[model samples]
Target: MKIHNSRLISALFAIAFGAMQTVSAAAETVRSLDDLAFLEGHWRGGEDFVFEETWNGAEGGVMTGMARGVSSGELKVLEYIVVSAEEDAVVMRFKHFRRDFSTWEDGGPIILMLTDAKENDVTFSADPPSETVKSIRYFKTGENTLQADIVLVEDGEEGGFTLVFDRAD
Candidate 1:
């Protein structure tokens, strides 16, 4: 009788542990930009996509920010217009809002698949193709020069143009 009781308790404990692990793994599977350590830095770039920006040739801007996790960490992308020295300060720089097939993309809410980060590059990809590139590569050219290229296609054009962001210091 003692042996049987011990075996039954052991089985129950094992089942409970399995359930706990399932929940933990599920949480990890859904990735947010805040989970990316490489994205922790401050990055400034331009938005020059003709289809997405009316002032595409002018000065478009991009800003990514992260915050501490409460229930879950949150990451947000802000798009605004960087006015020239002779313009107003209320210019918007970010996109991902409209749906005229010529606006910014909706926030890429996805779970990260893999993080193949390196000393000079950090690749981030998501599930179901929410963002342009599954993985964003940050390649360093010099002390103050880096290039980030991501491909964006509207309405499923495989040979679409690449949204290139160049950093000039």
Candidate 2:
């Protein structure tokens, strides 16, 4: 009788574990749009990047165009980023898009944490094993401008530049 009771207790414990996992996952579901609704306008900015190397001439430059949020399935702004083109498997995603059929996938960065509304900021770690490049993007609202600042961190240390933007209008 003791052996039978022990087996019954084990079965009950397994069932409880499965139920707890489901509840935890639902808690992590989309609670509100507070996470991504801040970035919703046109912005213009100049982007510049520098590289370190043993050789004398191996840096890069770009003319940046930026566009923010969308509605009714459209590209609403002119802002831009050339990051994914140079790197492999880097992608972007919004809450609306689906992974099974969307070309712009959510593979770029994890939205690690968020601040209050009307502020745009993100922490991104690109290619976890590669300590060569990782960064944070911080954007904020202004009187007559909308701004985004990009700061890169390498191997747990912070380096790179900040980009301040003006409203494109």
Which number leads on TM-score?
A: 2
Q: Please, what are the lDDT tens digits per residue for candidate 1 over residues 1-169?
A: 9999999999999999999999898755543322233333433443332111112222232223321111222222223322221221211122432223343445533333334445555444444554343434445555544455444434655332333233321
> Which regions of candidate 2 deviate over 4 angstroms?
2-15, 22-34, 45-90, 93-119, 129-132, 141-147, 153-158
TM-scores, one per candidate: 0.38, 0.39
What would the TM-score be for candidate 2 when compared with the true structure?
Answer: 0.39
Question: How accurate locally, in lDDT, is each candidate?
Answer: 0.39, 0.40
lDDT of 2 by residue, 1-169 (tens): 9999999999999999999999887656422333333344444454332111011111242112233433344443322332221222223222222323342324542222222223354343444422433444545656644444445456677677655556554
Which of the numbered candidates is closest to the native, going by highest lDDT?
2
* RMSD of every prediction: 13.9, 14.4
Q: Which consecutive 10 residues in model 2 have the weakest lDDT in total?
A: 50-59
Q: What is the lDDT of residue 132 in candidate 2?
A: 31
